[model samples]
Target: MSTGSLTGRVALVTGAGRGIGREIAIGLAAEGMAVGLVGRTHGTLSDTLKECVKRGSRGVAVTADVCRPGSVREAVRLVERDLGPIDLLVNNAGQVDAAEVPVWETDPTQWWRVVETNLRGPYNLLRCVLPGMVARRSGRVLNLNSGFAVRPDGHYTAYATSKGALLQLSDNIADSLARYGVVVLDISPGAVATDMTAGMPMFRDNRTWASIPYMVAVTVDVARGRFDGLHGRFVHAERDDLAELVEQAEEIRRTDARTLRLRPYKDDDPMV
Candidate 1:
């Protein structure tokens, strides 16, 4: 993790108005990447962009909703126009409105809204950004995910379902885009202080929280393509050491670890 590893790179971070998105965008700017802060609120996005500029790098704020394809396309165009081609796209915009409710008890509209924001948001960005990256044969995408995506869960069907699908989407895109020199990563920034998690019952008063710097450092590593071998796989900022993971990169690729999949009843189960 050298200083300025992202020098000359351009990154666009969604949900950058505040919280983890804001922190990571500022962190990337501190690493010398020109950053574009995207959010629905212009004033708040501007606030984050100012913080990034304070770190001594180019930072622009764009107001756009990730769930809207046209808005996302225009946001990408704006970012590229001002900051140069995006070297990294951080898909951090997400929703958790139905997070605390059971599947059977949640409102259909609200639940689907959560799914659309969490799942469709990144797809909208990719539909607009992937073509340019493929043509240029360069780019990287980081999908903000959750461990709950695969682990057992209760009263969080919408969030878990969307994240699981997002994980699969990351793997598929990684595999399809690798030949073009692009990589896709599934990063689960552990329970940190964010608007999304500040009210969680588990962290109501827990003074000690996961370090934002750790996740930012890992993201900077991903931005630099340091763990490309772990592309399409998942990593937890608070759990996995980037250096150690890089060391074990080959084994991870060989075994396809950190991915979501289905397992049969037994290893000896015969295939059709």
Candidate 2:
């Protein structure tokens, strides 16, 4: 929660052009990190870059599509060239295009596209970023997961599958990379009022909507490695304030019981 917590950090945020991504980039910038904004649209990326600058820190913008390996790799190169070695990687680029359609009725191509962006994109960044972090013996990688990863319904099968796979990948990487001091975590923002959720029926009730800035705070906490003790874990934004959530995770880590493995929970499951 300190103003300079991320002062020397350089963060690369995917999907940084708009909505939650833009807010997150700005939030990190406000925290004093040099932020690299990555997005496919030049206009949106430029807008985000300016906003990030206005938010009071160094920033750069890169155009890239997460679904394409070449694009993602190029974005990473650009970030390194413009910013610095990424101290933090926020895998926030993904879409839920298949959310309203039943799995059987979903277009195969679109479903695969969703998988490529939602799952493969994170993997691509992790593969590229891990070596440097491992060699340095310090870094943070936060994979943006979703509530649907566990509580998936018929309509969200493809999107949820992608997120679920991502969560598994995060856990596996955390387990392997811990010795090297690289911490990987899966964070679900959950029901934020971003462009992606504007038209959702649930958003019709204002009381249920969460603002983007709050989720950005969660990203800030995650980037700070607050949940380090519970590496390979998932945190829900709605559960508690950032520090309290981290403390809860630390408590879970301290249990040290053989039978206390974290079972991925459904969205509707009681958090208590």
Kindly list the per-residue Cα lDDT of model 2 for residues 82-109, writing each as its tens digit: 8889999999988875447778888898
User: In model 1, where is the ten-residue run with the lowest total lDDT?
Assistant: 263-272
Residue ranges of candidate 1 with Cα displaced over 4 Å: 270-272
lDDT of 1 by residue, 1-272 (tens): 33877889999999999888988998999899999999999998988988888888997899998999999999999999998998999999988753466678898999898899999999999999988899999999999998877785677678888999999898777777988988898889888888777776656787877888888887887887787888888988778787788899889888778888666578876641
Return the number of clashes found in candidate 2.
0
List per-prediction Cα lDDT, in the order shown.
0.87, 0.80
Using all chains and alpha carbons, the TM-scores for the candidates as numbered come to 0.95, 0.88
**RMSD, one per candidate, in order:** 1.8, 4.8
Off by over 4 Å in 2: 201-207, 240-245, 254-272
lDDT of 2: 0.80
Return the top candidate by lDDT.
1
